[model samples]
Structures are given as structure tokens and as C-alpha cells.
Target: MDINIERLKSTLMELSKFGYREDDKGIYRPGFSEADFAARKWLMSIAEQEGFITRMDGVGNVIIEYHAEDVAPDTPAVMIGSHLDSVPAGGMFDGTLGVIAGLECIRTLKAQNIKLAKPIWVIGTSEEEGRFGGMIGAQALTGKLTPHQILTSHDPDGIMLSDAMRSQGLEPMEALSARLNPNLIDSFFELHIEQGPVLDQTGVQIGVVEGISGVFKWIVKLIGKADHAGTAPMEMRSDAFMGLADFAYQINRIIAEDGTDTTRITVGKAELKPGFAHTIAGEVDFTIVARDMDETVMENLAASCRKALSAIARKHKLMFEYEQVSWLTPMKCTPSIVEFIAQQAQKLKLNYQVMPSGAGHDSQFFTDITDTGLIFIPSINGISHAPDEWSHWHDVQAGTELLYQCVLTKAVNKN
Candidate 1:
């Protein structure tokens, strides 16, 4: 049975109201905020009303399940979902699509009076946008969270993760108890809007993601002598901005020498000390975020960046320093699961591609614990985490259909 696209659209429209800002028309459900919790409760409320088993985990993940009467109580479940929380002003489809799509899958099965060999669970994960430097919900569920991380994590506003949980009447340490027994889950599936332009630009209707790229972040500093802009001779000045500029220019060269087609380097943030147009920048502080599918390539890219900055600093007669902030190793989807998804796509006669996701998702955490598959629908113009991000409704229908097929094949004893 195919998912009801109209029903899916209606549920998604209802969900968009929780954190919708009329001024900018963006969703504002950042992790652990009132809007975020409200959205979670709403999912639970609606699922319970519909006679589905539902609960919220300690870390605020919303779990909605459908268990056929014939299925044994202890049977492993097929879990499918994406994050519930969104980036500030994020689009409607980014994370919620997977959760709602899974919900629709359950609705379709029930509507068709289908019995299952396994139960199905749809989860809305928490803090996946990484407000506290981690995918808290998925990590907790996968037993990847630690007490130290729970205590130390904080938002950009300096609100501790513990405090955030406390404000919502949840004990911080309870997050550690949220881990799922790996045996209880048969596999995990996630359907998400490609927050990038790849699928859309290539005219592909479906993306069978092979893996999520690894990432590294560095905070770099360049120090030089400050002087009046007019008095400092152009040839003799130790200009920190010059050093930073030179490094920026070498990024392409570094990628060409040490990176592959999937490598990405971005200078997302930067600041010039003693800010004034009339003063030479004595110090430049910036961040370097690099991503690649392979750990070895990531290492080479990191080394290339360090070497380039050092040479640029020496040429400008400046001192350079950098701190490695964080590193996440690449996660590959289970090979069998990836191939299974591709086979399903071919069955549907859809235009599909095997691709790599440049962005992170909750599915990555499930890779080590269970067979995991991530599917992508295109974002219009590849825009996401913004007010204007969108995916066509038809594409959404196609994706949910594929998800339903996969879940059906895995969870049912017979059609």
C-alpha cells in the first residue's frame, strides 16, 4: 500500500505550526527550546490518540510504534525516523520528513489491514542540529553519550545541556539511560531532504546515500604587529589579514593536492582584532571546517591546511597557532542496506543515484549499532537551514513511497 500524500502533507503542515515565525516564515525549533518540546509532545499526543504506542525518551526523543497483534511482544522493531529539533529558521522538510514519513508508513499499513512479522517505530530525535556540539538524542540511543559530555555541553548562549534538560524538568544524567539495546532494533531507516543541490541539480528523484562525510574543525590564530594603516609601509608591515587572505587563496590548491571530489573546506567564521578601518589588523582569528569521506584524506587535508598557514604566516612575518576543535570519523551505510535500497529504487523505475551526504544526520549514529539506510529527496535549489528551503510535494510523495516499500519488505511476513 502506498502512503497517502495528502495525509502526509496535512501532518507536516500541522507540525510546522509549533515554531513557525510569521515574520520570516521560518521554523524556530532549536534543541530543548519550548517549541522543540511542544513539537515532541504534539507527536506523542497525536500518535497515542491514533491508538499507536508512544513515549518520550529521557533525552526528549519521541517514539511512536505500531505492533500487530500477532507479533510477539519481544520482537525486534524496524525503526525509521530523523531528528525532531531543527536549526533556527530551518525548513519544514529537513528532519521532520523522515519521522512523519515513517508515521505515514505505519498509517498505510494499518489502513490496508496488513499484519507484520515485526513492529515498526517512528522516532523524532532531539538536538540533532547540534546546538550543544552533539547529536544528543541519537548518541544517547546508540550508547555514544558520556557523563562528561552531558555535563559539559552547552549552547552558543552558554546555556548548559544539563540546565537545558533541567529547565524542561528532565534530569541530565537520565540521558545516559536512553540507550537502546542493539538487539531490540533490527535496522534503522531515515528519509531526509538533501540539504544540498546534488540530487536536484542532477535531475535525480532519489539519492541512495552511501555514507556521511567525516568532519574536522580548527580554530586558527595569526598574530602580527598593529600599526596605523597610513604609517605602516605596504612592503614592511606584518599584516595578519594578509596572512589569512593568503591561506584562503591556497585552499583550492590544498584540495587539489590532498583531497578528493568530496572534500569540502569552509572558513565559516572569522574576526579581526582591534577592528577599525584605520588600523592594521594585528591578529586574525578564524575557524576552518573540513570534510571528506575518508579519514586518511581528512588527515591529509588537515596537514595541508597547517602547512599552508605556516608558510603564509612566515611570509608575512606573523606568528600562527591553531586548536583542533572536533573530529567526527566518516560513517558508511551498511553495504547490504545500501544495495537493497538501490534495488528497491530500480523496482520503482525511479531516476536514482548512489551519493554521499555532505551533511550529518541521525542515521550516522545508527550505523555501528544496526543496518542503517538513508534516502534523500531533493531540496529546491539546494537551500536548507533557511526560511526559503523547500522540496516539492511530488518528490516528497515519491520518497515516502520508497520508504514504505523498504519498510514493508523488511517488516512484513507477506503482502
Candidate 2:
């Protein structure tokens, strides 16, 4: 049940160097980029060396299966993995740690000569960051995204996902065929950094995730007339930027009024057309990201946002449009697996807490078909998706040890 801390650290450090960035102060491996492709290749090489059968799906999900020679092929398998892609200038350990820990678990099981009733699959799902607004890789494997969807999605720079896939030597037309059959997988687990201060602040070494929050994303555009700042009177001008600013302020107020700690609203990206120092902006666009553990709360928040937009548009006399980008309902971990994780944590005498994740992860998608669970270690100061994000190596070891125990217990008990 003990993880080899030194080995885990060494593996993490080695992978950290693969997509390293000099200008950004850390790694910048965006989904489906060259750096991401290189990282996948490296992972496959490692899996091959570990005597695991490896293959990549059309959408570029890498599956490495570790088999017990005595086990029958018809037996359902246990899967442990996380994504390899990171947000621009993201932390080293967020997605990478889970994947490396999964690999390390397999290595440990092999080295210790442990036998199981089922095979183990260590997967490296692509595009969990959704940098292109489509979790194309995991979505493909889970039948959540189709080949046409992948072919049609374009980056901000106008490069199509299909082109990106072809550039990486993958066939885009076969993406739908890559969907992982629901029956093929019995259970899935992901190990991740908490990416929040709760665990570290509370002196907890591990977190057993109960659920992942739902997400509703939208782009709000305000249209007005552009005029010379000096010639336009403040009362006569329909300023798009001004209207947008007011709308953002009201959105915050709405979330505050709701008074739920889990209800969160953020305006992460914004832009103004004809951006200039001397002109009143003609058009403004901003993104809205709202999340909460409760689906009803999420729906209420979305309705409130729509109503706010309508009121703001009328007040400003500006044309308004709100387009839904995506929405995912919250997913709860399987209770039995959650209980098993809790049991294993207690057996290890590890300091742990049960909590809900504020961020979206691949486990949300996996929950659609099979039992899924998530484990978390701490991120220093709740910092993630940036160069300074970090977690202690000891915390990583503790989480991986718990993850290994949880999987072993579950795999053996499967009828």
C-alpha cells in the first residue's frame, strides 16, 4: 500500500521537462499541439518499456493496458488516468501527476507481484483543457463528440481541429469509431491536485471527491454605435464597453445575493471591437462561466443571467445577444467506490477530507457510463493554471498510495 515516493518524484520531474517553456516560466502544452504530441509519444514509449500493450485512438487517446497473463480477456478492466494537456502556462502537477501516478501504480503492482482478477488500463486522455472549447479527445472516447464536431471546431487562429489532428498523424474521419464502448470499462479513477487551498490550509493530506460542479459557459455581445470620444456627448452615446462593464458588475451582485459559497460566476475573457484610445467602442464581447454543485442552482443562475442581460440591454438601448457555448451538469462519484476510497484512506491512517471539486475534469465524462472516483492532493495556496502552481512531493505520494489501495480493493471485489 506504500508508494515509492522517490520513483514518483523522478517520473514527474522527467515529464516536466518535455513541454517546458522558457518565456512562460513553466510548461505550455496546449491540446493537440506539437508539445502535446511529443508528450504522448514519450508516454507510449514508457508504457511499452513497462510491458504494457499500448495503442492510440483516432482522436489521440493513448491506452496502455497492463494484463495479468492468467486473467481471461473477457473480464472487465479497471482504468486509472488523467489528461496530459495543460492550460497555457499551467502547473506541472495538475493533470500530469494523475497520469504518472497511474503509471507508477502499475509499476509497483508488477514489481510487488500482485495478481488481480482484472487487467489495468492506464490512459492518457487528450484535450481535457478544452483549450479549443471542445474536449474532443475524451469526448470522442466517451461518444460525447463526433467526427464532424472535431472537423468543424477551429482555434482562434483559424486552424481547424481536423488539420491539427492530421498534422499529428491522426485520422480525423475515424474519430467516431474511437468512442470507447460503455461495456468495456467497469470502473475509472483519476488522481489530481486539489488546485485549491482547502486541503493545504486545513492540513489535510488527501481529498476524496464527492462530486464535480456543473459548468455553464456563454458569450455575451453588446452592440452599439462607435463615435469620436470628443464629439460624442456622454448621454447621447451608446457605449458598448460601458454597458458590458455594468453587466459584469450586476452578474457579480447576483451571485453574491444568491449567497451560496459554491455558486461562482466569472468573466474571464473580454474584448472590444475597434479597440482604440479615442473612440467609443462599437461592440463588446465577454465570456461568462458559472458553476455550482447543484444542477437546480446552475439552472437558476443561468436564468438570472438571461434576465440580467435583457434588462441591461434595455437600459443601455444596445443590441444584446447571449450564445451558449457549452453546459455540463454536475456529476457525483459512485457511492460504493467513494466508500471504498474512504475505507482505504482510513486503513492507511492518512489525514483526509471528503469534498466537491470546483473544477471540471475527465471524470465528469466517465461518470456517464461507469463508476468513477477522484482523489486530490493539495496545491499550494489554491494556485493552479499558472507557472507558480505547486504541490509537495510528499502529498503526491500520499494521494497515489491511497489511489493504488482503492483500485486494488475494488478490482478484487468485482463479481
Candidate 3:
């Protein structure tokens, strides 16, 4: 209630304009795209208009800061923000909500004329949709991203990550040095949508995130000789498609039998080469993505995929190989910060629960550099990264208020 709900809505509306789509009502703000840069400029303009300092790091991460007149320059800042880019035809609330909610927190603090010992910074990160297979901004900020990864990565469409950064007037190597001083940021807080059914299904308003799932991805290929569909005998032909089918069936069995219920396996992309109505397919390129809250589970899932696919290739007389594209270990939220969020939800008398995130987030990377925590509001049907992905206005308001309270709790010096 103390937070400005109207301002929150208006900010989100403004950001949405940068990449609005009329077809499916989704957004297409791909990282380092012109629209994404426009959104970054819009955020900086707002910061400047509000008398806040603004800067864009080498990796295209946007930072807007509010400095107390008496605070020491060496004092660590408390940060609240999320990424600005979205997936192709992605929803509005996925990444933009956290950044907007953070801006509103700054506005609310200014309205009350409160000054903390430390600074408040709102960050708009880049490339967080795994376009390059990992979050570049947060990892760059903590100096965790390697030069090899940044230079060689590409999107599903075959767009080079380095080229994208170069087009935006940024250098990928410079991003490697985008590390923040360890003493400069004391803690980080991110308020995001649950992007799952747990909260909405259980009728909970607030979710104090306990951990984020680890993500492992592989790019696999199955190779075989194309043969005439009419001439090749069914028993004698070495079919590439058959190998793919066998892998798919065994993946299900692997997870159901060897993996836990929380484990997930997805073959989200597949391409068939030399398509012909009567010709047998010669080759296949597909991606494998597995997720779980435990790294061991993710490792086991990868092992299972390799073993099953290798056997299928041998049995079907096809060739198979895979590349481990990327890996992110699960991260646990800071205990004190998690407790702070719970206390605020209790104070507000809002229904809440402690939960783990099923998706990867920037908060997971922040854990390496500083104390980090996450706040989640319910998604309407546990849907995200799509046109219909939505969160209720009431839930948004409650989550923003909780974010405001949590920031104030650590931002003010106790001396």
C-alpha cells in the first residue's frame, strides 16, 4: 500500500512499448537488439530525470543509482533488479517486472525522504534468457564468465554473441573485466514471478525462494546415410530419425525410472536435414536440456542421455555425438535475507510459502559475489516466456511492498 501501484504499472507499460508485438501480443526484445538498447536508454532516461546516476557497463548491463549525501563512497550498495531482454515472443512480466519493481522501491524511498547509509542501485541485466546459454550480465559483474565462452557462444538462430555485443557498441573482452569491486555491493535482492504453478495452484501470494535449479544443456547430433524410402529394406536401412526416436523414448524411461520426480528432461529443438517426402532422413541436430535443484541429479541425467544415445546409435548402425553446451549449479538463497522476506510477508498478513525456483536466474550468479535472495509472486497458470504469461495486479502490488520493506531492512546502517 505504501508502494505506488500506479507507478509500477506505468513503468511496465513504458518498457513494454519498446518491443510490443501485435500478432501474438508477446514481446521480442532480444538482447543487444535495437529494441533492447532502446529499453536500456529509456531506463537511463528515467534515472537521470529522477536525479539518479546512470551507467552502462561493458557488457550492456544498465545501472541506476541513488546516493545518500552523507554515505561513504566505500560503503557497499544494496541492489535490486533483473534482466530487460526477453525471449522471442516472450511475455512482458518475465524480466521487466523485477527491474520495474526495483525502480518503484527507489521512488517510494524518495517519497518518504529516507536516506540510508548505503546506496540503492537498480540493474537492468542483459542476455539472461540463455540465448548464449547463460546469463552474461550477472556473471560478468562477478567476473565469472570466461572469455572463451563469450567469444564462441551463439544463439539458436546462429547469431554470434560477440557480434551482438559489438553491434551495441560493447566489447565482449571488456565484459570480462566488468567485475564489480567486492566491497562495492553488500547484498542483492531480486523480486520476480514464480513462473510456475506452485504459488497460483496453492493460493499463496508470496514465495520466498529457497534455491534455484541447476541447468545443463547439450547439443547432440545423429548421423546416417540417406536411402531411398521405396528401395531400402526396413530392416537393412540405417535411419537417423530412428536413433532420435529411440533417444526420446529412453530419456522418458531414464527420468521416470532412474531420476526423481523433480528432475526434468527436455529436447526442445530438432532439425531434420535433406527433407524429402519419400527419402529417409540422413541427419538430425537436436538440443537436450535437463534441470534439477541438485547438481548430482543433473549430472546423472546427462550420463543417462549419453549412455542411452550411444546404445541407440550402435544398435541402429548410426553415429552419435554430443557437446556439453553449458552448466549452472543450483544456488541457495541467503538465510538471513530469506528470513527478512518471510518477516515482511508475515507483517503484511499475506499468505506465503518457502519454495525453490525451477528456472535459472541472475540471483544464482550473485551468490558468488554477495549475499542474494529472491521474492516470487504467482504467475496466473505457472506460464512464462510466452504471450499469455501473466501475474495478477494484486500479487504484483503485494510483492513490490515486500521488496520495499526488505531493501529498507538492510540498506539503513544500524549504527
TM-scores of the candidates in the order shown: 0.88, 0.93, 0.95
Candidate 2 lDDT for residue 409:
72
Q: How many backbone clashes are present in model 3?
A: 0
Question: Which is the better candidate, 1 or 2, if ranked by lDDT?
Answer: 1
Q: Please give the lDDT score for candidate 1.
A: 0.90
- As a TM-score, model 1 comes out at 0.88
Question: Candidate 3: global Cα-lDDT?
Answer: 0.88
Instruction: Please provide, for model 1 over 226-344, each residue's C-alpha lDDT reduced to its tens digit, 9 standing for 90 to 100.
Output: 89999889999989999989998999999999999999999866889788999999999887889999999999999999889989999999999986755778999999999999998
For model 2, the run of ten residues with the poorest summed lDDT: 148-157
Give me the candidate number with maximum lDDT: 1
Clashes of 2: 0
Pick the winner on lDDT between candidates 2 and 3. 3
In model 1, the Cα lDDT at residue 39 comes to 93
**C-alpha lDDT of all candidate models, in order:** 0.90, 0.84, 0.88
